[model samples]
Target: MSVESIDAHQHFWDPSRGDYGWLTPELGGLYREFGPDDLKPLREAENVSRTVVVQAAQTVDETRYLLDLARNDSSIAGVVGWVPLDAPNAADLIDELAREPKFKAVRPMLQDLPDDRWIENPALAPAIHALIKNNLAFDALIFPRHVASLKIFAKRFPDLRIVIDHGAKPQIKDGGAGWQIWADGMAELAALPQGLRCKLSGLATEAAPGWTTAILKPYVDHLLKQFGPDRLMWGSDWPVLNLNGDYAQWHDAARQLTSHLNAPQQQALFGDTAKTFYRL
Candidate 1:
């Protein structure tokens, strides 16, 4: 078999679906619908053989919508769906979602929730356990402030596979004041033996306008060192990524950022790590 490359964190969303409150008009370019067909040519151009479509809206109906898409698209290796983790019937919901084989993970929209302590809510415990029982990973959709809490959450369920989306979204447009906090939080999270992974996505959008590969290298370097190639995954973060850069630009930048690593390590960062962490 040929060695594979996976774009482990892209999203498909439709404004007509109306669940995504974040897709506002001011968001400019990303204010439209995007689907697998829209991304196929881009992924093909970058030689990405597969992709993981993640949840863009905090709705179970959206999850169902994505699962339906995955069922029809051979290129979608897995889905990270949304479920109300603190719901009274969260476990039942997880069981119901588990019926779909393509459901590989759950991402509670922590970044959108007003309560930062929500992850620590005891009511979510059963749902977290259900994810473990069902063998579903937890995609942590969080910001830097949420990282310290995430470390504690990861410690609670030591075996639950966790991947921090967008490198916890460091503040790149501003100067690097947030770096220490984000870096410290990430180190604490990655230090957990529970197997934490980070995605090298969403960085370009965080940088100042007219950013380049050199501008992102430090952030990318920090992630590679903290998680290593074995625990780090490259994600297109697609359509949203178009806010700052195109797929080919991000792909080339990632390749250059990781050029120091040997062939095997590069492969691990590009595909193997995501394949194993998400069990894609």
Candidate 2:
């Protein structure tokens, strides 16, 4: 009944490689340099046997770099790399990336942008279509206001698998507590048939510093109700999570959330959901 764990949303970046512009000194110690070697200790400490390396920079090179890292390191089970959705040859790029078994999905960072923009822009539709055709999933990383866009995008591409990262990134710290907007949007997205999953990750970062499970419970509870354990997955968000807590703390928090669930349910939340959705 003991379930093996997988950290579904960790990030590794080499500042010397000149990519992560957001890691500033004000954010504290962990941002200096994060790589596979640095994450090994955390993995051991948390009993996490597998991980998914998510893209931090807005480049395909990051994806290729993670795939190469995965080739050398067995711990990284998958890579959620980014690609320019508006690019003309995005379809071809996805086709090529799919050839690598470790490349599981694509993520375009949509949270930083404005709310009115369409994810299914005419130019991006072909690329999205290619993702569906190639069996690659798309990670919907958006803010609360943009959550409603998923409804439009999901309706446009019924065959594509979509994962809402960081529980649609609610503004929990800002006291956006009512959550009517995010909760309604999540419900609409989950109703889609193709496949919709949500990551129980990054909540600590979104909440006030020193926030505890009690503070995060409302958002986590909402996701559990909307997606259920079957559609929910766990992720550490690693170095970013270091902003609020260490890897062990975040892993333990997830474990505490699943403490009441049966072993099979725990397995699905900890690893199986990600494995099945991302084909890891």
Candidate 3:
């Protein structure tokens, strides 16, 4: 079966807006501005017709900005915006954001937080439950250190739709040490009867100086075995991907990496699963 491809994860930000505080000068090539116009041609050249823009800043205005961008750009299918989960009115904020049809999910910057157990904070319960009540997905944008917490979070809210972004961001540069721990945590989340999905993106950024499809394939293969095609999706992770690679390069590499799969399976990995998961 043929599928219209959707780039499940990418970001757009304007430094002039002062929202992306993390996009510091140290980021070099990625510190500059990136927007839909910059990404449109690259994605179009690769035949990726649509994309979901994830939030790059923790500010709620950044989410509002993305929703506005999606409102004007048809190629932008949906957004995974940020919300202050610990706020007393987080559920109210989620309900307000849910009114926008393009606001498909929420991603708290878990990797940056000092506390690994931040998700487990009782204060976050309302926001997490609001996600389920609003029918919005939760994009787990975390590193391997936080994977164990994710297993606990999933168990506590089994019915909430969750997708592990960047294969839980394993450390691949040094032969992926502590991989067993990541695998064990991922297995725990996948074991949830409510189901979970993983994205096959951001490995190149994680691997950095030593990045290669061959080095990344084992990790992708592991997720394939754990979640299957029906629960896995692909993402470009865009301009951030430019730190190590470009959109076209990652797109081509991802296609070649998953080339072993049959047509139906490939369709799901490249497009269908994201479309279904994000309701694109």
Candidate 4:
């Protein structure tokens, strides 16, 4: 299979594995096993040629499990697994993980951590350096409040290819609550010299129930204005997307929202940009 329309940020997890601390029965339909098999047909329906499976659990074992899955599933073009950046031997772990052919990036679950400024810690320099040395991307999974510190981190490590996951997960669920803050923060990051990128995923989950493409258009439009299609990439956010919508629904909504872009620009958002950012 070749890379064309890539789902740049989706995930798979087995609650039975007991690794995903955040997964619980309360999440309803999302509290079950979701693998490539479950998403394969849906992605095929939408012409998603390949996918980048991301981490759901914050454990290295889970990261290894995801890589093992990718090793066997050719459709999985990349894996954004996790490593404890605050650990003493984080550099060693990163070195070991980077040796895997499918490990394209490392996400530290920054959103779940209580410390919004965790990524700005100086203690993480060695691990981050190892990431730069290994030529891997950094997935910043954060909320609106963490944007300031992330900017500082981006400034300090200009060489680290940083990607803001879910557009820093804007507060879209509450009618774009704090719109100015999210907008200004995203614009600031986009203007930075580091060339920080962002994923066009997980917005459905962040949106209000019964949300439509119209509700997401403003946020997506803002992203295009800031990062442009060359720096933005599309993703499904899949099973979690079930929280608000489903796979095909979100894909359709994304297509509808971006329908106005010309062929080249649309291609960049759906595939080319991710291909370049993740070096797929």
Report the C-alpha lDDT of model 1 over 1-280, residue by residue, as the tens digit: 4789999999999988899988998998788889989999999998998999999998999999999999999999999999999889999999999989889999988998899978887778999999999989999988989977887788889989999999999998896868898888888877888769899899998888888988898899889888999999999899999988999999999999999999999999999998898777
Error of 4 at 250 (Å): 0.8
How much does candidate 4 score in TM-score?
0.97
TM-score per candidate, chains pooled: 0.97, 0.95, 0.97, 0.97
What digit string (tens of lDDT, one per residue) describes model 3 on residues 36-106? 99998999999999999999999999999999999999999999999999999999999999999999999
RMSD list, candidates in order: 1.1, 1.6, 1.2, 1.4
lDDT of 2 by residue, 1-280 (tens): 4666888899988766676666666766855778899999889887889899999888888788888899999999999999888888988898899899898899988876554566857678889888888888989888777756667788878888889999988878878674888888888777778658999998889889888778788788888888989999999998888778888887887788668888888889999999999988
Ranking by lDDT: 4, 1, 3, 2
For all candidates in order, the CA lDDT equals 0.91, 0.84, 0.90, 0.91
Candidate 2 worst ten-residue window by lDDT: 112-121
> What's the residue-level lDDT of 262 in candidate 4?
91
Clashing pairs in 1: none
lDDT of 4 by residue, 113-151 (tens): 988888889999999999999999999888889989998
Off by over 4 Å in 4: 1-3
